[model samples]
Target: MCFDAIDMRVFDELRKLEMFFKEETRRGCSIIDLYELVQHAGNILPRLYLLCTVGSVYIKSKEAPAKDVLKDLVEMCRGIQHPVRGLFLRSYLSQVSRDKLPDIGSEYEGDADTVMDAVEFVLQNFTEMNKLWVRMQHQGPAREKEKREKGRSELRDLVGKNLHVLSQIEGVDLDMYKDTVLPRVLEQVVNCKDELAQFYLMDCIIQVFPDEYHLQTLEVLLGACPQLQPSVDIKTVLSRLMERLSNYAASSAEVLPEFLQVEAFSKLNNVIGKVIEAQVDMPIFGAVTLYSSLLTFTLHVHPDRLDYADQVLGACVKKLSSKGKLEDSRATKQIVALLSAPLEKYNDVVTALKLSNYHHVMEYLDNETNKIMATVIIQSIMKNNTRISTADKVEALFELITGLIKDLDGNHEEVDEDDFKEEQNSVARLIQMLHNDDPVEMYKIICTVRRQFMTGGPKRLPFTIPPLVFSSLKLVRRLQGQDEGQDENPFGDESLTTPKKIFQLLNQTIEVLSTVPAPELALQLYLQCAEAANDSDLEPVAYEFFTQAYILYEEEVSDSKAQVTALHLIIGTLRRMHVFGVENRDTLTHKATGYSAKLLKKPDQCRAVYSCAHLFWVDDQDNMKDGERVLICLKRALRIANAAQQMSNATRGILFLREGEPQVTAAAIQSLIELINTEMQSDSSTPDPAADAFFASTLRYIQFQKQKGGAIGERVYVLMFLGKRNVENLSAYWFTTKSFTTNLMV
Candidate 1:
């Protein structure tokens, strides 16, 4: 069928003839005969040489001699069967490595580098071989079947035989399996159940891969678990996922989730109380995401929802106050922080309260039940007492004050919307049962308070604690010591509504008036002192009361503009009883001829000077000429206007309106009108381009004419645009003066 086969058959017949010859010689075949027999065996010799190399290593460890022998076999196979057998031998030798051949010495022909080069050569050759064989397999219809069968058989032999041999090279690795062989095998097994070779591949992966790559290699090899393996199940998947989770958790960043906090029970909120109350079961990733979501809600949710806020904060407080292992540690710190957060961000709380009209929450507070009540009272007092409006803010503070006291008196129920309202009913009835002067009842009422004083501060109890209640009791003790007077005990008299209790109550209030900044404290104290006065009591102390009232009046004048204006108006009205009327203003007028002149030198400063303007009196008259008034008084003012004093735009403008009206002083009015027209025409002087200001003022003046078209009224208004034009004018145009103007200008 082939030349080599024919040669082999002829050679076999010759071998029988040669055997007869060898039998006669009674010895093995000579070297020449053996050489000739192996000459055509070059194509097959590479396989023999490789086997010998491996055998050498197995027999002698790394010290075996294999290189020189393999090189000599390579040369001996060269040109043995034209290019066919020679090329095959050379290709095979390329894969035979000396380093893997027992590390024998220089005597070993090839080294590890030789093995590497051989791998490259053989891999490329295999590619070429595949191309050639595949071409034969599909060459044509006539030869395709025979060619493919032969090609496949040859390929199988080449792969199975040489793969393990190449694997023995000292540095040769299994890339052929990974990049080539295994991929093909994997594709084949996608639908195939014959998994023995696949198992072999996986087992080799375990042995051949490094520890770092072993698990990952198994993962890749498993692909998507085509079907669950008997050994590997969902639990196995879960186990790996858990290990991955642990690896992720080793990071110490704040990326932990809210669900992880040991005490966190729910969501965070803008409310100081609720923010301190959230809880979580166990730590996880994404705390930043949850925290930011909470922040977003806080920023956007309406702050004025007090009822909603109370519900949320109340729930939070209840949750945190639940008994727990963390009660002594995180709970205490969190509570302190919550209390401080309100004070730190009190502006937002104030704004929210104002928006919701929930100021009553701050007003009627009591420290007896709630720990935060004192701060609330302080802030409320500060906010309300500093205000200056007709609004009745003091009502809230009063309700808080006396309401707490009323609730403390036994039989009171609702506690007036202050702290712990439900329990007040029980306390109120118990309080009524006690003897009015019983000290034991007071002690019971005081039990809920933690401390009476601020830390590191004054020894006296805070005024917010309703110190009047304590001071009243204390004053009673002092009065009992004052003299052994025969008067029935003032504070403890058992008669219904005892006079002593009333006196002590007044005295208690007097002490508080001395301390807390109640908005009505001064007025209430004044009333008290007035009632308590006796005929012979030092009159000067009443003077002191007057002095205090005077001081309060001054403070209000400076602190509140509306009150100052009202006070000035009241003083003016009172002065109308004595001095200020039209009669007085007439007497101070200046005399002049041709035009009886009247002038207010600077009416803008006149408000300050008019503190005494009411000292002059005048009676109303229908007819008046005030020209002489300005002529005398403004003689000096005119000199000052020309020299020292620079009149304000308002003052100058008013002067032009009064004196410069042609009906008053025609020459002066004509001169100003000429000057105004001159300025309007000048372009180089950068005459104001606010030409509309002129037109607007003109239109208005025309509207205000006395005759409904009076030329004089138009002139009066037109004079106002002097020194200012259009939008640039910031001066007031109208004045509510007592006098109309000079001459017949009215």
Candidate 2:
């Protein structure tokens, strides 16, 4: 380690100190070893440290080899072959070469201070040392000798230079090895005694390294100011520096990597935590700006940190929702508009809430409900396939609905069902909008999510209000202008786009749910391991979900229908769940052996469940496809519904299940069948959904009959056939002939 010009000046000044140490040593070894140590340390100190560290800065290039100046060391080097001599010899050689040594003992700790004092003493030796230090700096360090000295300009230059280099190296596999460079920079940034050194090194680091490096640095920053850790003034200064770092990265996003941008967001969270630690309520604006910049950086990074990013953004949505709720119309509008836009664009909201001042976002961003809607949309997106877990998405949605129900405490008249129904439709559209990419497990998740809304409520009969709550029957009324609800139907007018948030949230949630590996893991483990188990020896955990759906139909037919409609959900979910593996064929068996008898019984249940599991098939013609599939499911549901109603004990659960599936085909079929039966003046034990399902299935059967040239009265049941058509709704004939041709005389 050779000295730079300034370092050499320090040494030259130390040479002058040679006279002082020599002059003082002969005076009487006043401080004992201090005098002897000083005598030897003059050369040893710089040789070990300043030379080892700052010395590297003076090198013109990395290619240079060591320039050994001492000839007398040759004999000592040769004699180092001796064991004891080698130990002292190696230490002496290292001490002489770089003048820097590790902390070998308490003596080393005591002497390091002597090195700094030595450095200071040399600085005081000549006014020239000051000039030399300035010369070494591109522009002089900040002139505060008593405290932190900074050189923002030089630091900025280093950042720009490396930042450029990193950009150029974006995806390049430059063989440039930097494994040690970051740690070196870390120490330099953390431990720079000189304020100027500290500031410049950090500035250089933030600028030069890629965004990933910044994120890496932030993880270390978590260690910066631990809650109960002992720290020094350096720690204090470093913490302040961190306050500015995210903002600095935020300044020019091109230098920020997605990972760094994400970490900057996390940093905002950390900052919030810090504020809590400090017990500071109502943080300042610069802090807000810093947090906002992190958001700005994230939008630039795109989908990379979206999951963690959503956590931060979600806090704001909650805030804006509150503001919207308090009837702060402006806040409601702003929050809604912000939420309505693509989340990738909302920097302000992101920043404002990153620190967790959720109350403000709620109060200031938008109406609480609207904001909640936005949160649901966004969080739903995050909780969607790509962002989170099925169970989590389910839990999140359930939590969301529960929260809304808790908030809607006012006593409105019975007419307000429109409002409740409208909310339900919004939820319905969100649920129904599930695409092929959506996981089948999501059905169970959705069921589980809205299970609370399916029944239980404080105002209504246990859970009855939930069914009414999600039912869109009243909402369709409101859409026709029959009632003035707080919100409008999102799907009524083609001219009006779906709330961007609603759709995006759906998209995102699907995206997140798609990423959940655990369910997939469970699936994989079940699929692979269950194949090896004997049906009689298997435990329910081995593949319970796989077999659960089958038990419904079999049990419904045999007469133990505890719930009428629940079997439909189990079946629907099974159909959807089987999709991702529709092409895979495996031996139907338990996933594990040596299970409880309760789990292994009903061996046929597994085959029954899987047989209908592949029912909900999603294809390009999504609407038509869903309708067709749903129609079929309705028929299947009719059997279950009929079984439940007939069993007498099944009505309770069927009632619960009915509200959950507002669009159940069996329900619609039953509606049509009841109308038909009234016209026919027929008496029956009760409305049979299985019969309704048969009635609905015959729509296609009638079409098939027509294709085969059969007459109206030539089918299986003449009374069930359409003999004449009547267009009851005046608006119907103008739109389509189907309703006009099929509405009467069955």
Candidate that would win on TM-score? 2
CA lDDT scores, all candidates in order = 0.34, 0.34
**How big is the positional error of residue 629 in model 1, measured in Å on the Cα after superposition?**
5.0
Give the worst 10-residue stretch by lDDT in candidate 2: 651-660
Task: List, residue by residue over 346-441, the lDDT tens digit for candidate 2.
Answer: 423233233333333433432236426644554444343323335444454334344344333442335356555554445444443322223334
List candidate 2 stretches off by more than 4 Å: 1-204, 210-396, 401-425, 431-746
Off by over 4 Å in 1: 1-668, 675-692, 699-711, 714-746
lDDT of 1 at 124: 38
Error of 1 at 581 (Å): 5.0
The per-prediction CA RMSD against the true structure, in angstroms, equals 27.4, 25.7
Give the top-scoring candidate (lDDT): 2
Q: In model 1, which range of ten residues has the least summed lDDT?
A: 589-598
TM-score of each: 0.22, 0.26
